[model samples]
Target: MSFRDRTHAGRELALRLVERAGSGHLIDVLVLALPPGGVPVAAEVAGALHAPLDVLVAGEISTPVRPETAIGALVADDPPLYDRRSLAMMHLSEDRLGDVVVGERNELHRREYLYRGRRPLPSVNGRTVVLVDDGLTTGLTATAALRFLRRHGPTRLVLAIPVGNARTLSSLRDECDALVCLQQPPSLHAVGEWYEDFAPVSDTQVADTLHAFHATA
Candidate 1:
């Protein structure tokens, strides 16, 4: 199925998620978005539920030889951890692991500053935290985000994405408390291919969205 845009996809996904979420007397049910692509979709979800929204910054560690290939990702303010088996399967060198981690951490820091300002990360302790992203492809970014959030002691972690590859969704099932995803195409090409309006979300838009949320809060 094709989406008109990310907002359309998010609303549809949110409807499905709300049904599964059930009637709850809950606390700190924050929606954490992975910027800058996830921010737009996450905003719609947050508005739909009247829940607080925040950003979780992470950066993909690209393969040195094939720059487009994401070996893994590093979550902001979190210790570097990698899937040793995946690295071995990819035939990545142990010597390059440090460089990859350092480079990804630096990029993650840059993204953190770009997407978030002085505002502190929302406390998810004993709270149901819904993590939203536009789409999941390789799952590196989502995995990193989950690892970081686990440290924050959330009661539950619900990962919501508009669309995802089947393999990627399956990989995340064990990592998250709940998974809310719409379409899972057999031959997943790219996340942009599923949406009609697949424009890149800008950092300025992310900051503006956060500022608007803060003003209203």
Candidate 2:
């Protein structure tokens, strides 16, 4: 299965959500997207559900030795959440990741500012929170976002992605109240592989999505 674009995938996922929500799946939900890719998808979802849309900035921390591989994830202002498996594989430790964490944290904060401006993060307390991402591979960023959001006391924590690796989808099922994934291909590597037009999403695109959401909200 493949998507024409993020907008198309979002529309498809929104239909699934509507069906699921009718069967006691989602209620009083607040859509929180992992930008810059998730914004367009979540925008469609928020429009369909008539829910408020916001961003939960999450980023991967890559090691200097292997810049392409993510060793951990950075969410909010909390300490970076290390992928223990990845750490052990690279013969690394938490303390050794300090520099990488610092860099990723700075980058994540810069994005948070760029996307949301001076507006504070919306409250997820006592509400059903839907965490939307374009897709998942390692799921490290999703885990970090989930962990960080857990501190806010949401009534229910949901993971809603259009597609993901089969293994990752299996492991993540137990991590949240509901996991709404449209496709879980058994042999997957990158999220872009499942999309026909997986062009890079720019920072301006993300900001515009949020601006559009708030304009009619």
Best by TM-score: 2
lDDT of 2 by residue, 158-197 (tens): 9999999889888887778889999988867889988999
**TM-score computed on alpha carbons, candidate 1:** 0.91
Q: Count clashes in each candidate, considering only residues at least 3 apart in sequence or on different chains.
A: 0, 0
lDDT by residue (tens digit), candidate 1, 23-58: 663345798899988988888888777788889988
Each prediction's Cα lDDT score? 0.81, 0.90
* lDDT at position 207, candidate 1: 89
lDDT of 2 at 163: 95
Collision pairs in model 2: none
The best candidate in terms of lDDT: 2
Model 2: lDDT of residue 168: 82
Lowest summed lDDT window (length 10), candidate 1: 19-28
Instruction: For model 2, give the 10-residue run with minimal summed lDDT.
Output: 96-105
